[model samples]
Target chain A: MKKILNNPSDFVDESLRGIVLAHSDMLRSVGDPRVIVRSDAPVRGKVAIATGGGYGHLPVFLGYVGQGLADGACVGNVFSSPSADAMLTVTKSIDGGAGVLYLYGNYFGDKMNFDLAAEMARDEGIQVETVRVTDDVASAPAEQMSKRRGVAGVFFVYKIAGACAESGASLEEVKRLAEEVVINVRTMGIGFSPCTIPASGKPTFEIADNEVEIGIGIHGEPGISRQETAPAKELVSQLLAHLTADLDLVPGDEVSILVNGTGSTPLEELYVAYKEAHSWLSQKGIKIFKPFVGEYATSLEMAGFSISVLKLDETMKALLQAPVNTPFIKQL
Target chain B: MKKILNNPSDFVDESLRGIVLAHSDMLRSVGDPRVIVRSDAPVRGKVAIATGGGYGHLPVFLGYVGQGLADGACVGNVFSSPSADAMLTVTKSIDGGAGVLYLYGNYFGDKMNFDLAAEMARDEGIQVETVRVTDDVASAPAEQMSKRRGVAGVFFVYKIAGACAESGASLEEVKRLAEEVVINVRTMGIGFSPCTIPASGKPTFEIADNEVEIGIGIHGEPGISRQETAPAKELVSQLLAHLTADLDLVPGDEVSILVNGTGSTPLEELYVAYKEAHSWLSQKGIKIFKPFVGEYATSLEMAGFSISVLKLDETMKALLQAPVNTPFIKQL
Candidate 1:
């Protein structure tokens, strides 16, 4: 593989060390190096927020640990679940007197690990709540929504939950808010290429030169279809059609938009996709709130992007607009 | 090409339009859509800062325009220079009474286009100055410093100049400080893959599966050499060695570090690089300040990243720390 890595097996540990060193002001290592906590974590009387999954998706689990966002994160190897012990370590470190909330994308390994951690935390006398983000409409049919995978839309849940927790919300309130964010969100992705896992020293999947996979998952999971590549406008329309219809969005509905690049897609290409989404939403009489266009939730070096639409209320808007200062994201 | 684009020839325009539409709160189009300006531009007495180049690099020209950064930017087609007319339009719109500073990476096409724009602006009775960023140590030998190409190190110049201008520095002071930043900064890049320009619909360059090129320019210009891919630690060491030697960095020196991904490179990879850089600098007894790791400047979807070091002083540190809020970056 043409990846810049040290010992393939040590990729996650070394990268975690690098993250702590570079963002010393905002993050620090907890009991385990895989568990990262805010430098000033355990905010008294505040609901502590945490997330984890894999390491390839940077700025997802770790980058969100800062003011007005997640307080701790359990890091795993690239596309692998973090050890439950690592999650418990982070949970113990970040939990204040109030409680702790575990939020992450809906995936089998993540669900099992984080759930195990939650149970362990409870046994340790820490109040724990769990909410999984399931926003990828193409991951499952409408009847099997619970089986859908979470992708870029997870960022919306993190923002809302982090803001709610920062506001001194109770564990129940934070959990409910996170779930609400997940309920109103819909996401879909298109893949132009596959990313290699450093450890495996090969691509997770193979993609053709003249084709694209619509609604692909971050880890190279099959999407709805693989067809000849379409223009940005058509792709955006198709993705949005699936999402808007799935969400039952209607005229005059207001929503926030996020055009998140999987990895290798440039911001320019994302903006092109957003341009078309904006026009489509406008035509539907739907008001677009703070439209975000960038690489938010990414697959390591994957070439493509995802679109997430969150039907927003005044409270959701306020929560998302709250100030945040983190290594990957900053808003003021 | 497997890119999400429509009418390859219209890529830049559509992308720029998308940017403006999504970032309406922070950016707006001037006379020409190719020219994007701060929504609150021409800050009466603040020295206007502007940069322009090909459109592929996001958060470089347009993304940095905001309260304490650039005031406007002239955008061009992918990997191509903005027209003289576009630059003139942006320059006129952002010129506060204090004058305008044209700062951008030193490239033949950008220099000629911006120079022409400066002349036109002067004809219209607006004071303007140009500071070419030449920080890439790999592009040229020490004796041919002027021939060096600017890479990711241009970010240091932008942060310093923007802060200086925000502090109400006089036109000469801003220009002088900007040039000072240029003098102290050094950058080098390693490319694992080439980025395809939309207009061409083909890769700018080609590389073998297991080879990497060091000291590559953002536009896929040739680098020092193509060698078998090395470990992240080794690559970081080689890159830092070139930059530190060129900067004449000593044991007692303090510097700011930027580990920037050139697009396609994941944050995990960047942090891994930073981990090595931190250890190397610490062993040298060099103090690191405000170390940044992420995709700050990119070359579309090119893989690999760049390392930049700016030997810093108290003034430069303070300037870099000043508060700035924009769509892409926010600091407080």
Candidate 2:
């Protein structure tokens, strides 16, 4: 129940206010304060990529909006989907002359809201396309992959799609490229601690001190099972096993691994996990390309990390290396 | 301890191994494995900035070694100073024809070890200068500022000194610039929870569930006092009061604020604090330049944050804006 916030109801608005105030040069707010866009948004002839979801998972939902990233982001409350109105506002503000593309994680509430917003935007003579990131391999069986939830693997979607869109690609091209990334991405995570939502002032879920939840969802969703804690080497191997198998990865495969901290995990710990992952992949003869080891997505102060792998091609590798200047991430 | 690590003794070494593995293009380990240097170290005549301290605080000690930052760093165990031999190795590997500047926080163990290393390097015919960072306003009184512990304010030291040295400044000149930053910087922190060291599966410190410690140190050292958890506004106000007064900040002064998370504090919470600090400074007519609000330094998984204010001048402002490309940071 401990948090460094003032009024619970004002958490999202105040945080956004602070974000705009601090990063005024790179980002701005539209008529609806909940809709944030890059300062130079609506780049003429460039397909705009819009993303959004609940707050808390920073550098994810809103933190990715900037030059070389998403053109705009719709802000939502903690662990809650943004309103369709907010998404529509974002679509209207950042849609360059070309078209707008909706790129976000696959969650029922977010999908429903973005779909409604897309329908409304199309009614107003605007072209829109949707590409939901469903990369969490642990969320569903391979046959029911569509039911999987999006996780940190969404970083690849943003990197590839944002670069492709920035290249003046049409909406169809951008959507297809993003879909290709989603098809190649896979992620699995574990949770050791839970975070409390300000409004509720209650831990999202309870976990035993000596146990860890494998394949845990970002929102504290039930995973495969709770088991006694194990070394990072073992946990990383378990996650990568699910990821590599789901991707049908084999020797001679090339991939980009993102050792993402869910929240409270230390950066040093992520590197430790990365070391294990690198060793694991090396043993399997999988060449890692441009590995990202940090927090790309989070669940408030949840204490855990996830391992995400993005199978890469020459085109994806080239785009992934493109310069990106977001407030939270700088791949320059 | 609930850490994502293998053998506790191998934490620091394994993390550094992973770091070098991932950032091979930007950094490399000298003969001593514990001593890491920029991939392009000994930049002909550029003065090298050598920095190091204990582990755990990512982006602080070793994370600063890259282009436009520290030229080398010596690794140490968690919350423990590194050996003098490692520092000597770093100094020997990175010292160019100009000289070497040994810059690190003002801690008893670090000061002792670096002093010994500087002596050895001097005996080896390498020019050496030292400037210990003392920026934690909460650690000591203004009159005894030399005894204060360095905290996240070290970021300014690395930035200004690294930029100055990068410009081919002499060792003495870099030391002077770093000393100037130390004089202008002031920081204070608060903690809500404690983190356990992997070596000893016990909490570093403890407080009542609903209480918070003000003026807390990165090592879980005793702070001012514990009190009921207050909103970030009141807490930030309390921190800035000490920071501004210690610096004798005038209404027209310009400064850069670093809202630093000790470890587990969420980025959203840091921004909320930044909002309050920005408003507070604005009301006093003090202009903020280059505000950094994130995890510049951390204390394992302790849930707390610190506010560091650096009174800036034209020279420092220009230098601070210079491009920096480190493994943990990129200001390009």
Candidate 3:
């Protein structure tokens, strides 16, 4: 809660300026209320990809805007969606002759704002398509996976769709690939400690000292259930059970796994969880293409991790393997 | 403090396993010890570049190993150097036919270990070279810049040297490029809070509620001095004055600036510092090539920031602009 910020209102604006300055060679900002984008954005014949959300996730919004990822990103305040106007600016800035594709997580505020922006883009006679990633199975029943809330699985959509776009794919192809990734991906999170919002200087959720929550959302949302702290292997098994059960993953299935740490978890513990998870999947005869275990998506300083599995095929594999040069993700 | 690890001793090994599992497509362990290299390392005839250090700094030792950066990295326990055996393993794994180049910071432990490893490699009849990055102006006088401790400036060296290696440069050429980057770069850090080592479960240093320290090293090391908290602009000015005074800066010199947060500092505060720093540098007629503001190199859970300035020439500029695909550094 003791944040070194000047003012809560200026947080997003100031952070954006710094991001632009630091990555000026690779990225730039557009318009007055800046939206981040690659320095060479609006690729003449390629579909422009833009995604945005709240600002607390550093490498997510700004860090992800570089080569082989989003061409532009519109960031909102911490844990809040950007305004419709802000999205509109980003959309316009990255719209090349091939049109633009909007890819983002499926959160309530973000959904509404992106919808409004899409309508505004239509009014401006620019071709625009949208793909809302709803990959967190904890948010909905298995049969209604499309209605689930999005979490870190949105990263997969970004990777796959961005690769398609960077390869000069049409907006329709980029949107389709993004949608496919969203459908094939699933994510579930756990939080051991709650993080304090910088502006409020208060805990976002009440987590008991010795307890951990399974299936927690990234933004301090309530999870499926709470349980006592257990060994690393047991904790990973519990998470994997829920994730695999929700997706009905079977033996010999090929998937890409990600063990993402919520902000405060150390790399040491993350690796422990990954070790158990990798063994568990291997025991099930699952073929993992590339597993990413790090603090990809985080919630302020919360101590926890999330397991995301994206079932991969040849195309998804190639797209994932494509060279991506971004502040956070680097695929060679 | 209160780490989520099972045992302190297993930290590095377990974390390395998790990284390999997570990035199996991109990276793999070099040998039995704590060395990680790109899955497709030892690029035919290019100089193999390697770096290693403590494990607490994620994205620094391991996160920086990918295309356009290090060919391999050895990780030790938190805030400790890897043993010579570990460094030797990495060097052997990444030693292409062209020989190997080791680039790292100027910490005593690291220098001693790397030197021992270099000697061992030489005994094995393998060509080897080393470049110690010592760019912290706060640690040495201008005339003794080579004796200064290395910090975040090592990142610049990794980038430039990695680019040279990728271009099939000889071991000597890569070492020269890395040394040149170190000479042109200078960094100074300040700390507002101390980080707790996971093994100790307590803070590395103590600071009063109203105190901040300037010229702090990344590992919770005691800073040059402590002072009352000041405005972000004032803090940036103080740091810039100390860092830039020793370097020869004319009215219109071009430079690349990095305002790095030491983990706990919020992105918002970093931007405030960047805003003031950018304005001040521009006012001095310094042409900024690209300004980077983010948590690049961090002290675990420490609340502070560091500023690094690298005066640019055509080679430095091109290397900075080169496309790099790494977990942390992404130049597209």
Tens digits of lDDT, candidate 3, A1-332: 34455566776677677666656667788885558788887778888888899878766777678778888988887898998888898888888888888888888899899899989988998898998888887888888876788888888888889888989888888888888888789898888877767677678899776788888888888888898877677778887888787777899899998888777665556777888888899998888888776667777777788889999889999999787776555454
- TM-score to native of every candidate shown: 0.98, 0.99, 0.89
Top-down TM-score ranking: 2, 1, 3
**How would you encode candidate 2's per-residue C-alpha lDDT over B247-309 as one tens digit per residue?**
999999999999988888888888888888888899988999889988899998889999999
Residue A199 in model 2: lDDT: 86
TM-score of chain A of each: 0.98, 0.99, 0.97
Point to the candidate with the largest DockQ.
1
2 or 3, greater by DockQ: 2
Residue A288, candidate 1: Cα error in Å is: 0.4
Q: How does the DockQ of candidate 1 come out? A: 0.79
lDDT (0-100) at residue A255 of candidate 1? 98
Q: What DockQ does candidate 2 score?
A: 0.71
The TM-score of candidate 2's chain A against the true chain A comes to 0.99
Give the Cα error of residue B325 in candidate 1, in Å.
1.4
lDDT of 1: 0.89
Off by over 4 Å in 2: none
Off by over 4 Å in 1: B330-332
